[model samples]
Target: MISPHKTLLSRFYLIGVVATIVGILVVAILNLATPLEFIIAQLQTLRQGGEFLWIHVVAYRFAILCLLATFACVPFLVILRRVLTPISQCLSLKNRQQSLPPPLELKAKQRLINLPFIMAPLNILFWIFIPLCIFGGTFAIDKIDLAAAITFFIRSTMVGFVSSAIIFFGVESHARKVLIPLFFPKGELSLVERTAKLSILKRLRAFYRIGSLIPLAIIVLTLFVLYLQVNAETVSGKTYGQGVLNFSIVVFILSFLGSGILNRQISRSIADPINGMLDTMEEIKRGNYQTRVNVVSNDEVGVLGDATNRMIQSLAEKELLRDAFGRYVTPEIRDEIISGRIPLDGEFKDVTVLFADLKDFTPMTEANDPKQMVQILNDYFKEMSAAIKSKSGLILQFLGDEIYAVFGAPVSCKDHPSNAFFAALDMEKRLKDLNKRFVQQGRLPLSHGIGIHTGQVLAANIGSPDRLSYLLLGDAVNLASRLQTLTREMDARIIVSAETKQYLPESQTRNVLVRHPQPVQIKGQQTKVNIYLIK
Candidate 1:
């Protein structure tokens, strides 16, 4: 099927050409039938030409005059075809895939819009000169009925002017509705600015104003002629009154029909796309981001569609990214970062950092196949990571056989220290379940230690511009790692620093079995730390 833009454009040009040609022919026929032949017969009689000669001579003259007038318009037709040919050929193609190139398309639109200005004056001149030469030359002949000749001249002149006006207005309207929209595409949405000076809506309204004068002119001319005949007493008052009524009725009917057709054409050109956009907006409101408006034209409405699609597409992409990025951080932190609520530079917050390591990872690696070691490591990390995430802790880093997590830094929590302790306990329970399966498969049972410390730490994106990571910096991170090493010395599954123990609420501490506190000096720390072992 032809595209809507192409179809509307084709119809516009077709109507324009048809209206112009038909208007001229109608006017010419009216002129000939009403007054031209009678005027010719009177001229022949005055010349005293024999009746036989008069009959043959007058018919020949009328035919020659009409033929000359018709032939004189050929050059104007050629000019019009040259201007409109590209548009016609482009739209006439059966395959829509063969779209006109951008430059050619713009050229075609430029020519189409300029068509009326170029043809209207030329055609107007043709109409004026043709009527003047034929009637004026004949009127110059001697002894003709002066009144009859004058009437023929006046009537023919009126026909010419009215016909010219019809063609001009008709062609202008077509350019606005068809040519502009069809040639300008969605990609050229901004180019509508370039046409501000030649706005189609403004031009169409101007044509409507000028076209209104045609019927008014006809009314005045009819009344003037009737007044002249009445003064001369050549026609009865009743006949003149009847003629006025008939003329008024014909004008009203034609004007009403013409207005209806113009109204429909103008309204359709603008309404269709707006309605499509409204429906698309409704779809978007219902969260249907995938929906897109079918761009039917290159005007303002098409531009609006393009912008709307881009906005929805952007939202869809962000949703996809949010889901994918959420895997790296807790969903709360992910939402905070994406929403620009998180401070990326760095911030100090009290957080419990947990570090867990396989108790005998080196021995396990030496005994097992490399693939088996990898599988074991992945399974351990997956189980531990889920436990940590479930407790609202963000996994900061995974250093081979070890996991580091932070709570209440990127996103604050009033009970983060306790949450970290509970997550470590959950990890111990998950590890027990994993080891039972490993022993059933004749594999060694796995054991790990977790050390958690609560303190003020600097959490920030740190490293080179090209490569950076969210790190928990300051003595708190060191304290956590040091405590993990002490887990083996203390012969405990989990160890908590004095700082972390103090932060845990009594309600949570009551559920956890804790060993008596011990004062131990950790490596690289001058001050001794008090720590408790979890049973």
Candidate 2:
């Protein structure tokens, strides 16, 4: 897809092309109007001096060649845009898929591949062949001393080649490392890897910057030396050396200005989207999901911003769902659902279910004030619930002073039977602790009995559409309740069925005193079930 950033870049390129075309037309018209006669006249006068005056002809031809080259180069730039646009689009797509940020090495290799394909051939024609053509054209047009013209051409060519090589490689390398990576697929880089790469690039850039400065200084120094040498040899009235100095200064200034303009454009192209992405990321970190990166171009950075914004929107929606779900379900259940570990439709599983109730809750309610009864019940339930949770067993439901809990349901534990046994033991220990506090207060302690039974039960959501409870149902759940009823007969604080006893490890089961296995008729079951008591 054509990104907004790419669309903007295309528009900018079109505008640049139009501006270049107008500039070429203006220069061409000026050349045609001035005519070649004026140039020819100036050369004739210079030739009359005892000095072999081919300099004037060479200078005039150079100007004409430069003007024509500008016109040719502008069209080549337009062709370059045509070639680079599709490649930019492909890179935009690739960046979106990359999870790991692109490495500096990979980025360097890509630039190496693209440069030769897109610009190398054009650079050879424009920088190398074009200068040769200018010198040849001047030699033919003025019919000046061929040998003198060749010597000047050779000198100019050497300087131009050195200067152009330094400028091209310096700017291109900077663009590849800094500008291109920002726009391309940037995956997360490890700390060590990122730091090492950045350090290397920083050193390389510094070296290149210093290298570029040296050549620039040398070029200026050479121009100054040439000026002094020429002035020393020429008469005061003559300005031949002055003219050469002026031409050289103008060429250097124009080249510097052009390079500066290109660099600024490339920097802007790289910086705009990267800055936008950083700003958007900061907003996201601050919990502002409303923020979106403005698409400035159709390049890689623009595509990244678009994708990141979409991801933030998705995360915001999930946050909302989690907040809503958390109000109804426990965080554990919410996490299980969100993580896709627990299916919405619950499953049948083998679970050790526990049902506990205050033995004389109804009498306590009749004897005590409503507030006092509630306080006592809260104290009891809190202690028991904490014990159950500590064992990783869920408190499925709490009705009045009665609590229903289960182990190995929503999530299974390998030692679920042992976990349930520990929970019951802990509950008994807590009851003794509670009684001690009650005795110190000069009040009778509260008492509770727990019955645990292990069997397959349908564990699921039970209740109306508006109100739901995660609970277990079947003969196993009823057997647990029946066992709790037998607590009074067994004279035991904790009771378990024979089946539950079998599930516990021998280490834990060894502590229990089996009050001879007796078949007891539970309310829902036609057959009697054997139960045990823990001493």
Candidate 3:
């Protein structure tokens, strides 16, 4: 009993003492006020017929037995302490303390949850002994006849049953509210296997038996006994039977009161845990996956709470993975791949590709500190990537001083050329604003060149089987790099091939772009290329 959870066991042991006191009180009242007195009066009236009653003599015998029964509870309490000691010891050992074996922890939980059921029959058998006590003590000591002895046994059994019922549920209430919590802390009731459960069906059975059936049965039996005793005398038999019937009804009402207490305890055991689970589920539905249902029972509802928590935990993990996944791909491509809107396999598609580069990147790196140069490159890429992505372009990768981007392949955009051209315009506009802030902070201003071309390329997941990347492969990719290099020689900040220029929107082209004065010759091309320069 000396364990960390001894506090819980100590409280339950105290409750057991209090419950036994109440049980004795209930049994004492029922035995004294109703059965013994009622039966003795019936016997005196039937046998002695209007004679001065000797009910006082029977009362003396019953009083002596009642005194002994009260003292007998002392040993019963000792037995109770013995039963609770193992449970206390089990609970005292922490669930994970000293690496308690799985079977041991399961056994501890099973034993605690089954405590109410375990105590029920034990209480019934103990109280069931009271009837024999009454029949033996009174028959030997008071010299009561066979009829009186039978009456004492039946009446004592009835009252004793009521006491047992009260005690069993009292133990039940305490175990659910107190002991089970310490044992099965997380409330995964279903996980506790092969155990006797006091389910709703069992509750309904007790309610009927304690509240209605048992009491009504006793009432009928008493009335039948009175009817038999009165049958021998015709004059007052009817009036006397009515009197006995009235007494039986009063006892029945008292039994219903005991049943009501049991019902209240049953209600608490079922309703409270369910309400808590419902509140936690509402929070989970509102996107608070971090919230978990409090499992506080080893019942069906407790299992449900445990299952709901599993689902919430799975959702939290998936969301975390999604945030991590975003680091590797654009949200657009990520969504497309996840939604299965785009396939990963290779296919040839005519698409526009763009590349931007720092014109004098090698000299810039030689001049600035290594850390400051990386910071500047990242700061510039951050804003430039935003501009490219604004027109539905995916920034494929960031090479040193270069932004590799594509449009109209992975996630389709019909105006791939126009989208690429406008993204270049946005980059130029944003750089001017960015340089002012950089100059204000005493960091060097930055500039870059953009090149755009539209042609066929095989777009697919590429690389070794172990590590793959979605990449565009073909002359279009190489030509775009060539066009960006031509930016320095051509003295242009942003340049575009004639293939892309053909697709640019007619509305903006006549006003915003100018044809390059010379034909652009590239290393890998068989002929010179016509191009446009961003003004």
Q: Each prediction's Cα lDDT score?
A: 0.69, 0.61, 0.73
Give lDDT tens digits, candidate 2, residues 1-535. Answer: 8764465335334433343333333323322222123333454576675364566655776686567657556766766676555445544555576443346345433542344234434543454555467658878897544543453444344334333333334334444444444543333222122122222234345334433553364345445434444433333424544444554564455446544544454455466558878998899889888777664333355456667767887989988988876644346755876798865466889888898888887986998789977877777887887788778777777877888888887877667777888899899899889889778977668888889888898977778899887778788898898888778776678888888778777875675647556677777788877777775
lDDT of 2: 0.61
- For model 3, residues 402-502, the per-residue Cα lDDT tens digits are 98999887877788889899999999988988889899989888878888999999999999989998899999999998998888887888889999988
* Candidate number that wins on TM-score, 1 or 2: 1
Displacement of the residue 17 alpha carbon in candidate 3, Å: 4.5
Name model 2 segments beyond 4 Å from true. Answer: 1-335, 366-375, 438-444, 462-468, 489-491
lDDT of 1 by residue, 68-132 (tens): 64565566566666767777766655245586777666656556555655666667677666656
Q: What is the TM-score of each candidate against the true structure?
A: 0.63, 0.46, 0.71
For candidate 3, the 10 contiguous residues with the lowest summed lDDT are 29-38
Position 236, candidate 3: lDDT:
67
Task: Flag regions of model 1 displaced more than 4 Å.
Answer: 1-253, 362-379, 433-446, 461-469, 503-508, 524-526
The most accurate candidate by lDDT is: 3
